[model samples]
Target: MTATIPLGSRISGERLAVLLGEWRRRGSRHGSTDLAAAVEMYVLDGQLPIGTRLPAERELAAALGVSRTLIGAALDRLREDGIVASRQGAGSWIAGTGARRRDLEIPVTDGIFDLAKAAPSALPGLTAAADAARHDLAAYVTGNGYVTGGLPSLRSRIAERYTARGLPTTEEQVMITGGAYSAFVLCLRMLAGPGDRVLVEQPTYPNALDALRAAHALPVPVALDPGEGWDLAGVEAALRQASPRFAYLMADFQNPTGHRLDAEQRERLGGLLARTRTPVVIDESLVELDYDSDPLDGPPPLASFAGELSLTLGSASKSHWGGLRLGWIRASADLLDRLLSSRFAVDLGAPVFEQLVLAAMLEPAGYAALAQRRQDFRGRRDALAAALGHYCPDWTFTMPSGGLSLWCRLPKPMSTRLAVSAANHGVQLAPGSRFGVHGGMERWLRVPFALPSEHLSEAVRRLSLAVASVRSCAGVPAVNVPVA
Candidate 1:
């Protein structure tokens, strides 16, 4: 039986207006065309998700301060494009079912440069680690190899790493999963239920948002600034107003923006959530990937402040290698038990060999590998920045202190169009709105620096071409085209 989604029944008028940020392009003749394009972009980017009922035409017109006729014409354009479907009595909804469509994904063929993923390639030592793990795997293969709580040795190593990082944890407090994303889904299931509120930072990791949506949780977004990082005041207000059951945060080297919470901000957040008694799951997957910054000098884990109310999630995907597919949750023993009990419904446990490989990577030698990885990422980041400056000078982005990507702003609010254009030119780009909760941030883009330096240069060149294509279509002058 397909369970019904509890939330996303109807979008508020005010929310719809915010989603249609700066929808009207300069020199655009028709208001209806502009509105239709904006709504199409919103649905394509998964902001106004499929099956989400749009606000009434009258209500939207009032919110947008436009005439109802214009709203009706806009909906008509959307229906013509197959972006929206409407019935006489049931009202209008985004086209197709709420589930994602595979056809929407760009094919991974030759000459395609995919910057959609912020993951790095496997480390130099991965093969050696896998080979070494085979010897260790022999011991586990003698049994059924179906341990629910994960291998004791691997859990101990993960817990010790957490303790070394200042958040004292025990092996019993850790629950292993296939990857950080899996751990996030598990935590969401254990922490929240249908119709429960989950507070999150705006422009967070896209997959995290998908997990929340899949769990049928109502996500309340707090605005996060690329320049200033978290808007603590806004977060505090949301906590006080919504009193959400659970909160999800990326406190260290945040995804896309690479914004880290300072000590004072962490302290303030801790106090607010403590008073509200809201349980938070902090994703620290990129914690060890600090570039110019030193983790030793940075703020302690947010879990250290909230004590039992906070759960810290860590992964080897960023620091070590993505192929490892290893992640763990650091929480109280009671919470760990609950996670373990709930985990069985999904799977028995992660593969035994991969756990051994991860355990080996957590040793002293692995720390040395991490240092090398950090240096490599720093170089790649600098390379990407230099390439973007040379090729797409109009694009603006802060040089990230850490993490694998830069949250860039285009000269115009054409990120969705740019993404489509880039894909046609054999480059896969994640549009700015993909990170946003609603359809805002249309002027922004997430450019990953995890590729090789040469690939980074090539990507920027292709992106420059894509930008020219979009601008030309918009009847805007394309100046300063970089020579490839």
Candidate 2:
């Protein structure tokens, strides 16, 4: 029931509906033609890259809350204009033979089954914390809103957590930013400039790749096999050959592929980076979400080995709530001072209210809620793994002990096409290609279990339907890759 991979990227009907906001002309009679023309505008505007696959008509109709006939008529118009192409068995795609896959750098709309992000909803008692924070805010109201680095109290709380984990730290070693992404940008702007090589994992965070590109820094990648682990020899080679200005590595629960470096590996990698004198950015946003063991007992932070050479990025986005938009950086005191001095050029400081809210959430007394969150996430992870086993028996993925996603190795390289079909079937996906440096990991996909167990189960059921659609669309012979 699976198909070979397709070259193009896919968009879910729900995501597309969000992108095509207010596409219909008010009081217009010809809805189908108008719909076709709107899609043309998206193509022309480059929202829908060439070779992008469209969802099945039924899916689009459901997403748009329109009749299936309208969707069919719109497709008819699009096909006549050469805006779309389709065969009887193969599903429709944006008209073109081949096009480099384009990831729409956009947010997911609510109500659709969104698996594009690994973010879960706010932790329980967020409202009560905000209420507590309101009382705390009273102390700061008399003074001006801006604070350098971050609120001292929040930094202290974060430092305590880092110390608990293994990285002993004082408040001086940490600086807060708007979010982890902003923290990365602040470090990027500080270190390397245009054309400097930056080392990263092959299928690292997509937005991190986007940030690297935006800064005009060249990203040198080291491939990561989800089943296997980091190839330290290859990393050593890249450090030598690439001579990257700075390297970005996720030692704890690395994104996409939820691979964590064990204590031995961490010591080895830390020693390697320290020897090379290569500065690294260790993203620890998902470090706190480890389900199997206590976060306090996790391996020592990569920075522990690399010393001042490593700048660890911490975030509340995953561990707490993303809406708070609070994350921190841990570096050597000297480096933290330097980053703090230069941060104003980017923005003044993080918000006071959210900082207070997060600080409240992190208080030592709140472990019950935090423990409950991990328990819940672990349950959802198992549910998703079970759903895949039940619905798409051929599809394979390594079960992530912590973090939010399962990095799936498809039965075929149908990641891109499956994404589009999955969208049509009411599930949005983080396609495999979005993660690669050059956009071609068509055989893999990252499915997040951030939703509730029920949602995850239903989402996989829908994914099975999409998988069937993709299989039916494979006109070319399947390219066989060895499976374990």
Clashing pairs in 1: none
Give the per-residue lDDT digits (tens) of candidate 1, residues 234-350: 677677767788999999988878898887888889888888889999999999888875565567889888758788888888777777788888889988888888997777888
Who wins the lDDT comparison? 2
Residue-by-residue lDDT tens digits, candidate 2, 333-391: 98887898788889999999999998888876566788899999999999999999999
Residue 210 accuracy (lDDT) in model 2 = 85
Error of 2 at 24 (Å): 54
- Candidate 1 global CA lDDT score: 0.78
Task: Show model 2 residue runs off by greater than 4 Å.
Answer: 1-110, 474-484
Residue 27, candidate 2: C-alpha displacement in angstroms = 65
Model 2: weakest 10-residue lDDT segment is 475-484
Tell me the lDDT of candidate 2. 0.80
